[model samples]
Target: MKYNRLLCAGIAVSLLWVSPCPILSNEQNTSYASPAPAKGRAYYEERGDIVWEVPTHRKLIALTFDDGPDVSNTPAILDLLRKYDAKATFFVVGSRVEKLPHLVKREREEGHEIGNHTFLHSSFQHISRNKALSELDQGQASIVQATGAGTHLFRPPGGSYNDSLVKLAKEKGLKIILWSWHQDTLDWRKPGVHRIANKVLRNARNGDIVLMHDFVHHSTQTVEALKIILPELKKRGYSFVTVSELLSNREKPDGLIEVNK
Candidate 1:
């Protein structure tokens, strides 16, 4: 994903100074007041860059999954989540949602939140404006048709996005969502389950949006990790919530979004 280099660097540096809860001074407060464009220009301009990721100080975490409605795998993940009595955000591809509208409905019916991952899971940056809009439109329509759900949130495939794209989405009344923490499971690479679990446990924190997968085989590892990670977080007094619930208070147009899970 193409990311804004300056934005990426800024986040890394910012993360270094930000701990659990260091109340910002009055001057520091003014600087971070505005909500950023969730996905930056680079996300839509470059096909391989992730535009933006959220950073916060609250003790809440957003768990998200992407690229699926893969019948076999997605249901299992949902089942596991149900067992834990947890809810999360699923960024569903437009085409995939069409193929498995029932699954999409289940996601919403089950009390899980759904967001647009675009139609066909393609790069919003590389495609033409017309095609990009079509992808977004199709996905949005499919999700609504399938679940009677209104999704104003979008997560670009591969997290690639650009300025024009953000504007387009916003004009359509959608908010771009991205993640702050990555478990780095690379589940598609078939990493071990235990290892993936450990990575999340070690890196997760309050207000973290953890990225994991549902389509890949090794994603089972992510499920396994969640088993341990969720309990541990609970022990530490951290609560799990959908990306929107954690990022935004009762008021505010911005919220944390889970992506590329």
Candidate 2:
């Protein structure tokens, strides 16, 4: 039951791009499922192609935290972020934001950027088109209601997306934000802090988007790693930026760019 709850919440995280119509009542169609491994699928068939994780010559990196406005760990994470004088992105769940409006406000007041991670965080592929758009709209509404700010960026839950999903989000004036590299702190599994920290420290590079969660036990581990990683990267001449900031700085001609997705 505990695992099921987590899976449901995680799957519901893909609220962006849901259609506006009432959700259909059907367990097999509406219910969330465990993420299936798509490794053997073709690149286009796999969701990874929609994500970005590439190296560059610049001295910059973006740290993105997902699944919050958390009751646990968010305050501490914000405190640590403040202490380090570092700015990071938080891709918050819309429902969570409604519950923790103050946290969302605090995040915005502190000048950190927020991205929509959907209301329920449901699986994008599982939900209908109307549900997907509805989720994103609800998420945006919640963020504005909480923080009096608007977000132009979004990160699909489970790092998943499709052509229709992208089109829907873009039509709503949102950019589908996916990471290039992942930290996979697997904090959900209660991994050790040291292991999580080491993986991010060892793997992150310029233009890479490192994924971490701010809502669970392993979050502290990622935070701990950040304390070391942030300074070390600084020493190595790396500058940290929000995902939008990083994306905005990428050189482009005619202001036209491809969706990294």
State TM-scores per candidate: 0.71, 0.74
Question: Relative to the unseen true structure, what is the C-alpha lDDT of residue 164 in candidate 1, on a scale of 0 to 100?
Answer: 62
Candidate 1 lDDT, tens digit per residue, 1-261? Answer: 357887899899988894677654443232211134455445542432232333456676778888887878888888877876778899898888888999989988888899998888776544566677788899899898889867977887665555566667777777777675355556656678767777677877666677777777434666666677777777777766786776462212364343432
What C-alpha lDDT values do all the predictions have? Answer: 0.70, 0.73
- Per-structure clash totals for the candidates: 16, 25
Candidate with maximal TM-score: 2
**Model 2 — TM-score against the truth?**
0.74
Candidate with maximal lDDT: 2
Off by over 4 Å in 1: 1-57, 181-184, 217-219, 250-261
TM-score of 1: 0.71
The lowest-lDDT stretch of 10 consecutive residues in candidate 1 is 26-35
